[model samples]
Target: MRVAVLPCCLFSLAALAGCATGSKTSEVAQVRMVFPVQAPARPQCDAKPLERLALTGQVASQELIDQALHDSRAAHARVMRDDHVADASINPARLNLRVSVDNRIISSSCG
Candidate 1:
């Protein structure tokens, strides 16, 4: 009887170990965080035709700004795996992002 029980005990342990190694389903509550970004100040300029030149310059270089934003979003997603990026807004003042992040992993990632 002891020998029979030993086999049963070992089989239970093996089954438990398999369960431990499998993916765990966990509920992650809503996560919210605010990050302040200093918006770049618009260049000081007089209201004249020359302002058109500045505007043109800004428009032409907009691609760089867009690239920067793409990089930022990608980096944020990589760091916060549980949180999905809901929205991103950039005004003259700052960049604000609303992320549906996994609060469970946020603490571990320190984001």
Candidate 2:
């Protein structure tokens, strides 16, 4: 009975080894490789139409607003009377004007 059991265990292990070594070609065929591409840089605000304004913390006035609009060639301008920049509602092609509570230009950005 012991001799018979030894042969059976050896056969089982041999079968498992055969199954483990069965195939690598199928796995290699199933895999694919990919490459990445670089993206273009965005244009700066100074290069656009709003370059004329003093920007950052400057006093906001009607004349300055008009000049910015004319220089930027934007369709229109919206003033946000907050100490911080507001959520973006303007079009990406338009200009975003951020102003302070005291009517000072906080900063300017192009959407």
Candidate 3:
């Protein structure tokens, strides 16, 4: 019984050797823009300073994508889409807005 138990313990330890170590930090970033309602010709440069916004806690990627679509849809600026029209109300007025964003993962704390 002792001999059998010794082999089982050794096997378990070997199997878990890799699992005991921590993984390297991963770098990831994403950007999203949304327009729920009509936007001004030149929307005011109203970005909150980094300190004022919440970058941590609980947020999902899909939510951000949905927001980007919604915001782009609502912007009043002319976007270059094939279906776009300059209009008299008879034809639909397609939006012409451009949204670009960048993100980076820095090795910093949330203080």
Candidate 4:
């Protein structure tokens, strides 16, 4: 027991000493925004073509939804399920689809 305890105590002291030595170091946080990164231009979506695929109040399949998104040229798709909060910010290339818990599409619109 004494042999084991001595090694553990020595290791604990060494670990504490290591931590204390590292504390004396200093780091400078520098952020250089030489040129702000620019995002690619997003095209405006046309929900009309997407609405044609709308079988409202019915379950929306992933493939069907994907096709609609492609037709509308929407950059992003927001599917709002029951009790799921969605961001209100509008994106011209985004497609908003309100659905029930079972993936039934309630309403589809492009922002």
| TM-scores, each model vs. reference | 0.23, 0.48, 0.20, 0.57
For model 4, give the 10-residue run with minimal summed lDDT: 25-34
Best by lDDT: 4
lDDT of each: 0.35, 0.67, 0.34, 0.80
Candidate 3: residue pairs that collide:
33-68, 34-71, 35-70, 35-71, 78-96, 79-96, 79-97
TM for candidate 2 is 0.48
Q: What tens digits encode model 3's per-residue C-alpha lDDT throughout 38-79?
A: 655643212132223333232324454234334434322222
The weakest ten consecutive residues by lDDT in model 1 span 102-111
Superposition-based RMSD of candidate 3 using all C-alpha atoms, in angstroms: 21.5
lDDT by residue (tens digit), candidate 1, 52-82:
2332223223453344234333232222223
The residue-by-residue lDDT of candidate 2 on 11-107, one tens digit each, is 9999988776665545554553233445775433331546555667777778887677667765566777776566756464456677878888877
Top TM-score model: 4
TM-score of 3: 0.20
For model 2, give the RMSD to the true fold: 11.3
Candidate 3 lDDT: 0.34
Clashing pairs for model 2 are 49-72
